[model samples]
Target: MTNPRADRVRDVAKLAQRSARTRRGLFLAEGPQAVREALRLDARLADDGAPRLVAEVYASAACLERYPELDALARATGALRTATDDVLAAMADTVSPQGILAVCRQLDVTLAEVLSRGPRLVAVLCRVQDPGNAGTILRAADSAGADAVVFTEGSVDPYNPKTVRSTAGSLFHVPFVIGADPAELAQQLRGAGVGVLAADGYGPVDLDALQDESAARRLTVGPPVVGPLGDGTLGDRALGGGANGEAAPEGRSSGEGEAAPSYALEAPTAWLFGNEAQGLSDAELALADARVAVPLYGEAESLNVGTAATVCLYASARAQRRGQRTG
Candidate 1:
């Protein structure tokens, strides 16, 4: 084993973390599965895992003086802990350090890259700041045969440990992108020829309403409806939200078809979900041509972010599947 006395505090590991932070493109992963995921990341962050033996490590000599076990761990592991307890706090994601962390690079992709050929489905994480919620949505996106997933500006980083774990290994199954600017995103989707849709928990139309009789359809979001495309023209477009904000553009389309024609949900589309605390912003919402929601029969005020998102995306997947069969 390497000797702690021979190692410096600013070794390769610390440098790697600094680089990642500087570039806004680095993450650290611990455990075998997380390491595997790091390797698979488009921006491969690390190939090896930092090992913390059954010893303690202190961030500083003062900390060591305060907590002798931390020093003892250093003696055991041969890795020098930094000089700041706060640094350790930030680095230590768990209540206790696992002694194993893998540094990784972030994969920043564009709209075109996200919507690569294969399927015509899209998952939009508008402002879902909960890392777990974000990751779970990605997992669902992969499971539902999504072509890609888009994360808006205010969303959490998908590489967060909590978020990554929530994915349940779905990170490798599909591609996801980040859209930092709503206006830029709108242009990109329009350029890519991908329809943009938003999820409204209290939307007027049912999600199933996006379908056409002939199997070709726009992306539908909302609850399941009785009739097909354009069947239920919502006169009561009352939206229940004061907790969110948005910056969508004028004349932006959310795939609202004119007049009820036999429509289907087989068209290429992207669906945007919102934050755990608050839903999508008002300005951002205007970008959507139409909105839909799940009809919760129970008296629950609203569903949790994960449950609601799953319902929205799965509804689209189901519509597309049926459309494909008919087509």
Candidate 2:
């Protein structure tokens, strides 16, 4: 157990600041959800081994009694530590501490490694400054079954305590990279046969139009039509695996008058979203193969980054899983 004034406790408290976190190579997971996820994923933020993820846990006695699962995780990881309520409060970034907190290494990966998987769906956040919006987008990406999310340079740090909390534990579920170059990322994804679409308010391609085109194409070809090669030519390998003319999965059809199946969303796609206030810059959006505008029915203003991303990513998920039906 440690008192609020102890040196070690104070060191942990210092991580609340970005500068301290950068120097120490650690961040705080302030609540049960984030802590449990850190333990479950056991991702290695640094090259070191044996320490594992979730190096230490601090909880008040009342917290331990209330959330026995968290307590068990601490015990199982050999990371259990005791702190008085006041000590825990001093370490927390939130007003209402969840009574549990963990010291975790930052979670991130190289962009090359992220793209090596040949991801089917991805979201790229460009210059998005809000931590809450960033975290919510991550949660939406996870929900949409996106293979990964990329946080470009000038975007919020994924490990920011508020962002981590906003994810509600989804930060551990999906692979993400921070501080990546937007143009380079687009080049890499295109090289991997992934189509990059920029989500802009005045883009050329319409989301619903893409859906309609997808539904119509699915009727002719067996599966959703992934784009041709980077050179804008229809190579045999255009549709990813379906490029080899692999037959669509059994019992799938785009019947006439039926709702436009979300087949376009199925194609290997990555959506680039800009910041809330400024949106994507002209130069930044120019890197994409195409620009997609989310159709707004109501007269209300534009969609926020998080909501727009959720709609875009899930549209792809639904399109991709259209005939597969596995969930």
Candidate 3:
């Protein structure tokens, strides 16, 4: 494996392209961290009698000595191969592959499979174009304990080299569904008892206010009851009503007669984060039960999608955990 011009090197290098990756159903995971995670997942799946994820591993001798755990995990896959630094670089997407790389099978699951698992928190990326942003959001979702991450049809491919690198190995730790339709996905999430929320800069609902209400409910005298909108009297206030318990702000109310949709921060929720430039489309926002905006006290115009998502997901995670404890 010392020759960088070998056919095997070229084959592995081709995975950097989306077309090649799709054709082979394989992608390259470069660097010690990414490859180690891939091999670890492969080992876990294998232990569970599931299909293995790592198809092959190419590592330099120095890498194996530097990270003995990677060497052990790679050998456990029964697909480890020794290669020179030149060969490793030739087969990797990164300028410096960090002495190791692995070829892994795409691990995306179906939308039905994800819903069937009864996920409590999910992140939906709607037409997010940047690979780095998508990866960062996925990493945030993983850190926030989200059940899964969903990428809509127009979103950037999660298997892209830049995205895989941007994830920093979090890609292997989370379950994700690809190519979901926004409208249909929303309906499905609702059907599964999951509330759909859109992250919009101009949204009427204040995220902080929702958190405060959630905390108050949890600490109240009575046990918290969870159900659909209009099931209880918390609708108006939870949506966007003022502190005095009057009607919500103009254009923010549900209607004159009907109660506003209930969006308890503790309930099962799937958040929709839109593109870096355009944000969520009007149609996409309409798919959500409510649109929530991350408040800014400072002079910043808006928060990045990744940062906003971290805030929203962590909010849900905290509320959900508190609900579990208090219920």
* Highest TM-score scorer: 3
Predicted structure 1: clash tally: 29
Candidate 3 colliding pairs: none
What TM-scores do the predictions have? 0.64, 0.84, 0.90
Candidate 2, residue 226: CA error in Å? 2.0
Of 2 and 3, the candidate ahead on TM-score is 3
lDDT of 3 by residue, 173-261 (tens): 99999999999999999899898888876555567767887888887887555533433333333232222111233334422343444
Candidate 2 has what TM-score? 0.84
Instruction: Return the clash pairs for model 2, or none.
Output: 266-320
Candidate 1 per-residue lDDT over residues 120-204, each given as its tens digit: 6788888788888788889888888887887888788776667766786676567777645776776677566666666765444
* Candidate number that wins on lDDT, 2 or 3: 3
How far residue 136's Cα lies from its native spot in candidate 3, in Å, is: 0.7
Query: Every model's Cα RMSD, please?
Result: 9.9, 9.2, 5.1
- The models' CA-based lDDT, in order, is 0.55, 0.74, 0.83
When summed lDDT is taken over every stretch of 10 residues in candidate 1, the lowest stretch is: 241-250
Arranged by TM-score with the best first, the candidates are 3, 2, 1
